[model samples]
Target: MRLRNHEGTPVDPVPFLVVVGLTFMFVLSFGPLYGQALGAGLELSVGVSFALFLAVAFGSYYWQVWTARPETVGVVPASVRAVRLFYLMLVLAVLMIGLAIPLML
Candidate 1:
């Protein structure tokens, strides 16, 4: 499957994956805690990892658009803005839930 940028442009997966891959690698390198959790018992860790990866990817896409499309600022339709805000909140909630699950476990 291919990844789309915030503006629905088909982003080059090579560059996007490079950014996300390095981020995931950096995360796993922090300590053995994640590894132990994954190996020993906590299956939620996998979900958390995937959720984080998605969050980072979307965030990066938005950041790219924000920087590259300065002229499009203030031209967004209200409905589109609302939809974006809803998705942003939903993703944030998912991120929080993912983190909370690890702590709860």
Candidate 2:
């Protein structure tokens, strides 16, 4: 499907792709994956990992919105908005689980 901003503005495909790419990469590189990789006295708690994930996601969202402006200043389809939120929340939940699993062990 398509992606939209919290403001219900439809995001262009290119910027959306870029945002997803960067967000996923950041999450993979510096989120729980990095923490787990430390594998010693450097283990991070789930709270810290989730917090970092939120920060990275927030920053990525804003940066993308700024980079892909103009048409993003308007409204989008309700279905599109709903889908975007659902997808984002699902991703966040998965990230939390992934982070927590590492710490649980």
Candidate 3:
């Protein structure tokens, strides 16, 4: 029921989400578009929000990377696939929380 890459690899959700988040933030960082997107808000406010989002996305993405290590998820003596998944999850979580700080400022 899912799609797999030509190399027989499934799509990595964590990275996929991170990329999307980054793209969104990048677009928002533009001055004219930023103002238009969030009308009536100060420029600094938009910048801060974008910064926070960038932080969260970065943090979580890295967290998942650590957790997804093959050695870390060797609990069931499985292959590297499971390890990758674990790290992916961890990365996503960190990214989500890390993005909040700059936004709050």
Top lDDT hit: 2
- The TM-score of predicted model 2 comes to 0.41
The model with the greatest TM-score is: 2
Candidate 2 residue spans exceeding 4 A from truth: 1-62
Which model is ahead, 1 or 3, in terms of TM-score?
Answer: 1
lDDT of candidate 2 over 3-49, digit per residue (tens): 56566666665755565665665565556555556662334634466
Q: What is the full ranking by TM-score, best candidate first?
A: 2, 1, 3
TM-score of each: 0.38, 0.41, 0.33
Every candidate's lDDT:
0.60, 0.63, 0.55
lDDT of 1: 0.60
Each prediction's RMSD to truth: 9.4, 9.4, 9.6
lDDT for position 3 in model 3:
29
What is candidate 2's CA lDDT for residue 104?
Answer: 59
Give the per-residue lDDT digits (tens) of candidate 1, residues 1-105: 565555665545554566677557644432235645557434555556666777887776566532344445479899998998799769866865675577457
Candidate 1 stretches with Cα past 4 Å from truth are 1-15, 28-32, 35-40, 65-105
Quote the lDDT for 76 in model 2: 84
Please, what are the lDDT tens digits per residue for candidate 3 over residues 25-54?
553544334454456467666676677667
